[model samples]
Target: MDTTSVWRATAPKAALPSLQGDIATDVVIVGGGITGVTLALNLAEQGIPAVLLEARDAGFGSTGNSTGNLYETVSRGIHRIIDRWDKDVAHAVTVARREAVDQIERRVQKYGIGCGFRRCALYRYATSEEGKERVEKEYQGSLDAGLRVRWEPSLPPPFHPPHGQVMVLDNQAQFHPQAYVRELARQAAGHGCLIFEDSMVLEVDTDQRVVRTVRGKVSAKHIVLATHSPKGLHLVQAGMVVNREYGLATRIEKDGFPAGIFWGSGVDRISARELGVDDETYLICVGEEHKTGQEDANINLDRLEAAAAAHFHVRDIAFRWSAQNYAAADSLPYIGKDATGCFIATGFETDGLTWGTVAASIITDEIIGRDNLFAPLVKPSRFSPVKGAKGLVEENVAVLKSFIKDYVTDRPGIPLSQLMPGKGDIVKVAGESLAAYMDPNGNLLLVSPVCTHMKCKVHWNSVEKSWDCPCHGSRFAPDGTVIEGPATEPLQRHFLQDVE
Candidate 1:
């Protein structure tokens, strides 16, 4: 069972029926994940009649598989932001992130959604004395950005080489993101917003401001491409964003965990939190950030699980998942009108919860013809001579790599004859070794077969009876269980052998 897909586990049954004929609306939003749904909700609140098209069910992307912690700022490396984006831009991004958290909180209170919402602090600690300098530099950056942050020296365990320090910011929080988004979707539906699931958008007419899905076409005055990484824009060579992240939830038996959101300062940081599911205790572990299509996401999970075992007493493994975010090379989310009628809110990296909210507000503001505070920082068409050049080279290189590796090279496909009844194999399928297949009665079944989030080879975890993305920690069942995410899509089935 894939434990990585949060929407499958948390959200109510989605309203998905094949879209019939041509429909017209004032605005059409593609991608029903948090960004898309939240954008729709924002627009509805402003009395706009918009229709949302989701490739799958709502909250089926990072929102479903999130650790649900709304870390309002860059927890990884602030220096990276300064390197790619201007100081003012970085500062505005931070403020926008905080505003995202505030928006979520406000919506929760307004709708009375029961999603385990809480106000907590986020801690970023350094592993070594050298790392302490980096942490302090970030602290100073926070201050220089007019945000006061507290520095704590001599932290407890999990801080290897303990001579280093830590930084903590208050008022950060987390929750069951699926439940929260479901409520948002319900409210949006009540407020005159239409959401259609299982509607994969195949094309977009930026010139005409029209969106075409597998079933029907939608003609609208404006369009919002909030599909995490801009799925449809790739055909146009306008560029799309991609980044990979991992998360895990473990059953903890230990006491005195210090109950707050915790993270590290290294490139592959680790975050831990106490999560409640029924009567059991689960510690949500997250980190292992990297560019999408850059590396095997499972590697991050191994590193984080090792850290979790070292730091906390585990009773059992409850769930593990991964998420991918679109990181613009400029280190800012693309949240504005691109052409005349098309708007986008992507490249948010891993801060989508906050940035998604920012995107929603800005996109709504754009539709309403109001001045948006985030306009200056999140311009979609903004060009950065240095970052844009580097990002273009890097992203295009990845696109070329994926195209060559995933598409053109067709070798001997996985032999379904090798699969036996009631057995599964991580054999070479889909031209990649990470794909898996199983047979209940001698039939070749193709599920997501591969982890779409980071192209990590998913392992058939027999113990869990699920396809586990060992790299970034996403899990799905032999029957294609989307228990976790970053991967909103399921293990697509390619039946190779017939059951006899």
Candidate 2:
């Protein structure tokens, strides 16, 4: 029941002080995930003064919650990219991602980061008849994307053998993401980059290039909003689809676990991998993706656990967590300056591990006045409604629906006294709807159910104990504190006393 990720719980910690006073630097990177930390290290090593601000510790976001699989293919399948754009664009995406993975390998070797970095083969197999066809298509897509792929008769032991052929891609890699990002932060700090932890940016003044936290602020010429989906409402958020995926890891075992990235197909879509890091081993399985804030978290998580148990003969589930991803309307991540003029990296979907590195490389080049070949492809300014019409329309409709439900519908709310212990709900208080949560100690915490990012209604995420925005994926704590997503302001708080 400990929802902490296995990577985060097992990885060693690197404690860094929070930002104290006002400071100015050449470049300021927000959010200390892989992208921000990599950019900080790359910039500082080149004699550029940079600083990184993290709301929590490094890699505490989706980066650490990731499956830790590194490959050139996107999780949604590269074939869709080719169909949306062209074969050339898909090839470019794969090439850029491969280079980023190589760069990660180089860093692991150069810095001796003990993150269980290893080269392994990735296998894509199917279980049902429909899934068999999907594997065939994915195999063709991999080849079209200029990857070295082959077909195997069936999957090996420790796996439910495929219903048909298995597509194998060699040279794919995996690593301990939490450990790698933490090590990258340490190295960046050693290279003169001021890395701050637990310093959440409360305000971003784009006009003055200043970002202010609770107790400190940083002004920089170049601002990189490496936070997932970017902070505050951006034009890109209007064109992206946000989703959450579940991940679970089994108890440490000595052997009998598979040693590759295995992705199953169809309604039984599950991505599985084994890890041997820091003298520990775990079999990790991740899948079950749904639109954020729109689905029952407990049901989705339980379904994933059921599938994991059905497929793999693994140990007891030890750790369980989830990750949020944003897919762009045009099948590509927006990785550069937008209309607001700040560098933003988002919409990487579930393939952010490789895309995050590619984004860091591209953004670093742009700030240093160097040309990166892949920069123009994913620049945030590009508008391709013809290619992105599907996602754009869905995003707009979702926003409108949230607004209407929050403003138009007659919402049935429970009275404060009817709110049960260890539960949260929208309660009617003096004719106003407010988010109310009752603690185990019989204490009540109340806050507005409105998300500050875009005035969208917030829904309770039962699994994570937070309020999630169905509009833009912003999440807040039960106390109205901002957790993540594009919301920079916390929810409005309401207090009541002696009112059952």
Candidate 3:
């Protein structure tokens, strides 16, 4: 199976250039994922000039690796929002999510973006008694949130038909995420927005309203931190729990394959959707989530492959990829101006496809001096101390435990001869910890094991072949380039001859 995402493999390459020198705009957006690109498009459409800076190419990050399902319900469940806040907030959340989906549809049509966007039904099924109860509670909560859901006694074949009850939510959508986002960047550029790729923002001066990169600086009237986790605000990082989830696409037989999204409840909740490329069809299955750097990536991949094999007629695994998500302690995304006055959007969990659009809408409204209806509910600075207290403590405790354990633990100290090609591990070299990897050509590469974000030790992700930070989900390539992050810097490179 290919390690690349199907979307990335199939989507067209983005051709945007990097930032050259100092530039100024009405707004500066510091990411090029769905949120940043969408926010750029929204602002540009409103006749606002903005500059978008991407560390890498557009959609190269989580947006490219995402499973591409759009849903109105939050990843943790709608009931969690009801329990934390009130029914009104939960209902408002649902409404806002639906609006985000509709906005995507409208933009695709209006811009003539051929991203294979399609509306499909979503089925949430239960496989166990606990799952059944959870589904029932979610069903009621969904209805209370003004969603139209129908109860199904059984799902069709190729799914757990008679084993569990199903709740079907209609009019949800999916698309080629990378394709859509790239088109969004193009459309934003067409509207006179400056789009830059490979332009990393090294620092943000909130007081001066300026962002600086190695090559240039952007002074803006407003700024939006659309990075996966907001680097501009430290508190936003602390309030989120990072998760790593795996996905695989398998070629499927045409006859029994389902046409809509299917989700199963329980601890090992699984989601499946079908995609068509040319005349061939493939089933994309994603699940087996764990805290970032907590579980073995190979194990998660195996579980997903096993599940896909058991449920459907799989010809072969076409693609395998993984994405990271950050869930807020309060079950809602922080999507407005933070205490520092810079607009931010993060903690989207698995529903970023929709919430990213919602963030764009809300941020654009704020930039254009209009009031957004959902801004107050999702404002970044707003906190529910009592309602989110337990989750905040639990998530932070996990972070602390991981930080201390990685900091104190000794490395395995495996020699370069013992390391296998296409794999990496942490080792002790010259009385210092180093991340070591052997390239396919038998060349040894070493870098500092400490994550640049918070100095936490980074563990090697075998499946993805990268060093992943446990504390905050920072990832780096074996060559020490920053892949994804709350961290902005690459791992420090170490010379092989320096080894003991």
lDDT of each: 0.67, 0.90, 0.85
Residue 311 local lDDT, model 1: 58
Model 2 lDDT-worst window of ten: 250-259
Candidate 2 lDDT tens digits, 283-305: 89999998888888999999999
Cα deviation at 361, candidate 1, in Å, is 0.5
Per residue, candidate 1 scores C-alpha lDDT tens digits across 326-403 of 566666667877644478777766667777777888888878989977786667767776866676777677666555
Rate residue 470 of model 3 by lDDT.
83
Q: Give the TM-score of candidate 1.
A: 0.79
Q: Supply the TM-score for candidate 3.
A: 0.95
lDDT of 2 at 52: 96
Q: Candidate 1 local accuracy as lDDT? A: 0.67
- The residue pairs found clashing in candidate 3 are none
Candidates' RMSD to native? 5.4, 1.4, 1.8
| Ten residues in sequence with the least summed lDDT for candidate 3 | 407-416
Candidate number achieving the greatest TM-score relative to the actual structure: 2
List runs of model 3 lying over 4 Å from the truth: 254-256, 409-412, 415-417
Question: Which of the two candidates, 1 or 2, achieves a greater TM-score against the reference?
Answer: 2
